[model samples]
Target chain A: MEEVRNQQVILKDYVNGLPKESDMLLKTSSTILLKLPKGSNGVLVKNLYLSCDPYLCCLMSKSQVSHLESFTPGSPIAGLGVAKVVDSGHSNFKKGDLVWGWTGWEEYTIITAPDALFKIQHTDVPLSYYIGILGVHGMTAYYGFHEICAPKKGEYVFVSAASGAVGQLVGQFAKLTGCYVVGTAGTNKKVELLKNKFGFDEAFNYKDEQDIDEALKRYFPEGIDIYFENVGGKMLDAVLLNMKTNGRISVCGMISQYNLNEEEGVRNLSHIIMKRLHMKGFIVGDHFNLYPKYMEMVIPLIKEEKICYIEDIGEGLESAPAALLGLFSGKNVGKQVVVVAHE
Target chain B: MEEVRNQQVILKDYVNGLPKESDMLLKTSSTILLKLPKGSNGVLVKNLYLSCDPYLCCLMSKSQVSHLESFTPGSPIAGLGVAKVVDSGHSNFKKGDLVWGWTGWEEYTIITAPDALFKIQHTDVPLSYYIGILGVHGMTAYYGFHEICAPKKGEYVFVSAASGAVGQLVGQFAKLTGCYVVGTAGTNKKVELLKNKFGFDEAFNYKDEQDIDEALKRYFPEGIDIYFENVGGKMLDAVLLNMKTNGRISVCGMISQYNLNEEEGVRNLSHIIMKRLHMKGFIVGDHFNLYPKYMEMVIPLIKEEKICYIEDIGEGLESAPAALLGLFSGKNVGKQVVVVAHE
Candidate 1:
């Protein structure tokens, strides 16, 4: 039996507040057996691309673990990734098959539950696309905007964390539905990308604005009809005040509140009553059934270059920590992806 | 034509914070003609029972008014009430018809839109029931609990302000659905009424509990599946933490926050994301279309004595201000009704 070095990113300890790069350690000692052991049912795969998502921060804390499991200190941190099967004892996948789903943050991983992975069919698009635009973020944006928000033509829509993976797509989806779309990003550059590249009606850097409610009021003078709540806390408070009668808020991720010991209080929830708003929180895993329907709509747009995707890529496994950490500070311009291998 | 002196409750000014009895002045200056004016399209109604509701506090504030109109200074305060049509110029209403809908807080009122009034057909039940269990509170509790919450059999249900007008009915409705029902009130007396009269599985005085979250966890060991949100603020904050996966919250009113200049901020809103909670705010006026369906179900319940109703009646128009003001202090137990006339 032959073994090979597998560089891995391990959670150093349970994170207390905002996750720092030092909270994760890059180790090279971990190795993967070249061949599967006797009676093994797992598939051995080499990770190609790994996603750096905001919700990963929630899983870092030991206290919050209902939706996702907490990252153990000594083990490789796991996340949604693109991988190529190097060896397999599973019937569904064979050697050289491409897949995406729950995989370890390592150069190579042994996927015990091979059925959990999604087999890649389209080789025309970049394989890294599996980590973002075609992955969990893609499904979330589709289901949340279309099913939850129930966007109608000419309605006013707002998206927070508007330049990030899911936010960018939600804004585009709103625009495609003939809705007036506005987005909020942390940086001026990301804001520019939202308006110019994503074709949003208006975009603003929330960090530059002194008052979020004033910023929302300026963008949505008639008041927002639908709000895609990606960053909760104060943003949700401001959006609640600016929401129109019969408004909808799809609570996807509250990245701003994820790292806090006690999440910030939202003061304007009474507006939920006054405005007759429907605010619902949903997870991507719950809506996997919509993936086929999502692909039928989004694939043609991607093929025709009608929809645009912006990605901020990190080069290697060592860069995963910084890429993930950058999410909190809004350092990444678009979808944050870590490329572990070129293939 | 004979003209009679009409006693009225007039708003002194827009209430700043919590409303006081002095904010509404009992004036007897107005007079109404016994007969309708020629070429008129209105109904002259003698006010019978005026409902003292917590949402009136929202109307007291100058800032909030989207669906309902705000009361102007020196003008009569308007609300849901039971009235008798003394004279009718409208085709739908005749003389001596009992009706309920929007009416002024006066001894006699000339209702311009007689079409807005719902004619009381069943005289078997108490006439005051038209202002409460058969009126706005009834429809609100019915629509909010059944239509919005989508309660399932054996589901754990929690109602805030459980002994109040709408809450009491919602608790009973949950019990009828074969749900595990628990409720909270400000006083132990109301709590006892919730458990004994309303048939809630358990009840607690929220004021007694040092930690509301703990109190909820004690009663709902499994977790609350449906929450009828009447009083928002810290209680809502606590409920958010105790809500189960895919919990539903029908937000009817936030009485606690209505009086405050700066409303209390809810801290555990993030639980909505973790638990995949669905929260919707609604007005009974929006669900008026469901009233016929509501009456079809509730009239039988009332006739069979399957549901119990409790009212704290205030005699005469002079006690109107005290009754309305008492809602903020939890003074009047059950449905607070101010009787202007017996017949």
Candidate 2:
């Protein structure tokens, strides 16, 4: 086995506020053997599609208290990536197997915990879909909406950051469930994408609205039954006021508050009691067991044109840093992915 | 039957911020007919015990959005009360039948909504107990703890306002479920009552602790699994930080915030997502169907002396204003009830 140059994206240092592109460095000095060592219980993989997730920004932070393992300043930043197994010692994954799991931001990686790697059963669809639409992001939207929010038919649903990787899917899922769905995004383009392309009943650019509460009251006159909360802070405060009795809030992410030095205080939390609301928070990794069921339900829809997924792909590993940081700035139009090596 | 003077507690005006005793005027001008008019559907009752609940303060405000009807100035204040049927046109009640329901804070009155009146089968317990231990306060504690919190054996349970009407019962119920319970109160006496009388595993005086989060850390090193949220300002914020993964919070009341001109902003609600917490707000009034089942479960425990309820009785209707306002100041030692008349 020969050592190959592994071009990687590395965290320059732990980020403070909104992550700058310089916070991540692209390095080519890293090299890895394209073979698993003898008797080593690992799978050596050539990374293909690397997912640019908002949660990766949380990992770039200095906070050690978070459930996600923080990225070391000098280490290669890691995230969910689709890969082709080059060599393997693990029984589940063999050589030439298409898999996706916790892989690095480099061309090649030897996954020490092969348990994290899942074999791709159907390659009938695009393999890169495993990184976004068919991966943790997809599963997150599925479990977070169907399980956490528990949307009923004809219910009023609201999604924040509506055109992002997860939010776009949540809005569509709400529509598929026969719910009256409304979404909020930073830019008019994303808002337009939400209403026009994603089949949302209504969409609003929150930046245009002077008062978020008044905007929500205007859009949701009857009040919101379910809130898919991706961007928390003032938006969450507004949603709390607008929620109807027995409303459910699925706390998928708080991207708006994550970069702030001090998280904004939510003033209308007592409305949860008055309205008899249920607010739950969940992690997709914890609900991975639902993956097979998720695919079974989602694939038929995708194949039949009953559902759609939009991907915004960066060409190479060099673009990974900017693409990943772009999430906080609302730069990516749809599901953000960086294409590394083509199979 | 003849017209009689009804000594009543009337709202001088809608209260602002912390209610002063002067906000409620003791009026003797009110008069009512003791006889039920022919073809009338109402029931006339002699008020025995009037409940001074924390929720009444919310009614004193001018917020029409609240589920509770605001107290109209110059009109008699109304709340949950134990009464004796003097004259009845409603079939559910007859002369001398003891009943309890929504009644005016007065000597005698006509209950327009006779359906709201519940017949008291068990005079075996103290009649005043109907206004405290066996009424909405009891049911709030029961449903809030057993249904919402869904306590599993050996789970860590924390209750704020631990010696108050609802919180004390929640702590006791947690103990019955084999949970390790900790409670927080405003005073050392109340704390002692929680630990010793209520059989909580531990108790703390929140007033004594400068840092509530650190105090909770001291009490629950492994972190809280169930938090019965009664006072929902700073205590709720602190509890959010201390909650374990998949923690459940039953938001029964936010006494601390009800009187504030601008309710305190909860800063750590985002922790709900990071910790995968489930926070639900509920009203016992919505769960009235569970009352009979609750009575069956709780009556036996009360009869066997397995559970205890403490009542802080104000002498008469004149003390009602002070007793109700005392809840916010943490002046009432236990369940605050005003005894208006004797059997």
Candidate 3:
């Protein structure tokens, strides 16, 4: 058997607040074999692209009896990753196949639940897209908007964190559907990307706007029919005032308030009941079965160049921490993916 | 033509805090003639049962902006009321037809848009039920639970303000669907009403429970699958901790935080993204067209005694302000209604 080794990034400890580079440490270790043991159904993979998402910060935090489990300290940090199968014992996956799912933040991984992994059949696009635009983040924007908000052709759609992974895709999808799409970004460059790259009808730099209510009014004069909520808090309160009757809001994330010791108060949520608005929060995994359907629709858009995707790629595992922390600070331009090793 | 005059309940001035009995004054004058004038489509009606909803208190506050329109300081206060058609030039109605919609707080009202009025078809149920269970509150609960939450059988359901107007009906509906249901009320009496009268599996008094998280754990050992949110703030924070993966929260109101100068912060909303949960806020008026469907489901339940309703009735128009303000104080046992003059 070939010599086996895994380069892994482990969580040093449960973080109290925002994670620092010291919280994670990467180490190279030797493995006995790449093959699964007899009678075990698993796949061994050499991980390539790893996703650095905002939610990973929450996973590193101390367990506060949340709805999800905190990532175990000392265990390898796990997230969406694209990898190639070196060896396999599962029926669905064979040796030398490319796959993507919850893989270790490492150069190699032994995934037991190989069923969760999706085999890459289409190689027409960049393989790294599997960790982002064609993966969970892409499906997230698609299902959250199409399924949750049920956007109409002429609806007014607003997305917060508009330059991020899911928000960027949501804005694009809205524009393609003939929506009057507006988005809020943290910086002018991201705002420009929203309008020029993502094709959003209007874009605003929330940081520059003195008043969020005034900002929303300038973007949505007739009122917002759909709000793709990613950054919550004052943004949500302002959006509530600008919502028309029968508005729909898809809650994907609240990145702004996540790390705060005390959460921000939202004063205008009562408008949901008054204006008859519908605001729903969702996750991509719950709607994973629709991935195939999402691919069917999105693949063509990418092929035809009707849809454009921007990704801020960190060169190696060493830069993963900075890349992840950048999400909170709005530093990443688009879908943030860490390149562990080039294919 | 009858002698032309208008008796009205004028808002003396916008209130600052909890509205007092003196904040609103009922002024009497001669009855206005029921005439369409030369070319008007307006219908004239003699006001009957008027709805006393919690939202009216917000309109009374000077600091709050009324969502629809501010009640003119020197003019009559208006709300959803049932009225008897005295004369009509509008196409939909004629003299003697009973109707319900927005009407002024007076003996007689000159309604500009008769189209907003819904004709009374099922007078079999109490006409006041039209303002409570069969009206906005009822439809609110129905669409909020059925459409928003999309609850499944055997799911664990929790409702706040359990014995209040909309909460009572939501709990009953969950029970009917074979779900495990629990509720929170402000008083021991209302808690008892939730368990015995509303058929909730478990009920607690929020006032008695110092630690809401502990209280939620006692009722939901496996965690909550659905939360019908009425009382926002601390209760919402606690419920967020107790929500299951993919939990659905239908935000109907936040009675606890509404009157506050600053709304309370919800620390556990981050759970929304981590748990892949859905928290939706909706208004009843947005789903008004579902009234026929709601009535079809609710009317039979009422007739079969499967649904139980409670209303704290005030005697006349003069008592309307006190009845409405009672909602914030937890004084109203169930739906609060004002009996101006029952047909």
Q: Report RMSD (Å) for each prediction in the order shown.
A: 1.1, 1.2, 3.1
For candidate 1, the lDDT comes to 0.91
Q: What is the clash count for each candidate, in the order shown?
A: 0, 0, 0
Q: Best to worst by DockQ, what's the order?
A: 2, 1, 3
Question: Interface RMSD for candidate number 2?
Answer: 1.1
- Native interface contacts kept by each candidate, as a fraction: 0.81, 0.78, 0.57
**Tens-digit lDDT track of model 2 for A213-264:** 9999999999999999998889999999999999999998888888678778
| Candidate rank order under lDDT | 1, 2, 3
| Inter-residue clash pairs, candidate 3 | none
What stretches of model 2 exceed 4 Å from their correct place? none
What is the two-chain DockQ of model 3? 0.49
Residue pairs clashing in model 1 are none
* Model 3, residue B168: C-alpha shift (Å): 2.7
Interface RMSD of each: 1.4, 1.1, 2.9
Residues B145-164 of candidate 3: C-alpha lDDT, one tens digit per residue: 98999989999999998898
* TM-score (C-alpha) between model 2 and the true structure: 0.98
True contacts kept of 3: 0.57
The per-model lDDT (C-alpha) reads 0.91, 0.89, 0.84
DockQ of the two-chain complex in candidate 1: 0.77
Can you tell me the CAPRI class of model 3? medium
Stretches > 4 Å off in candidate 1: none
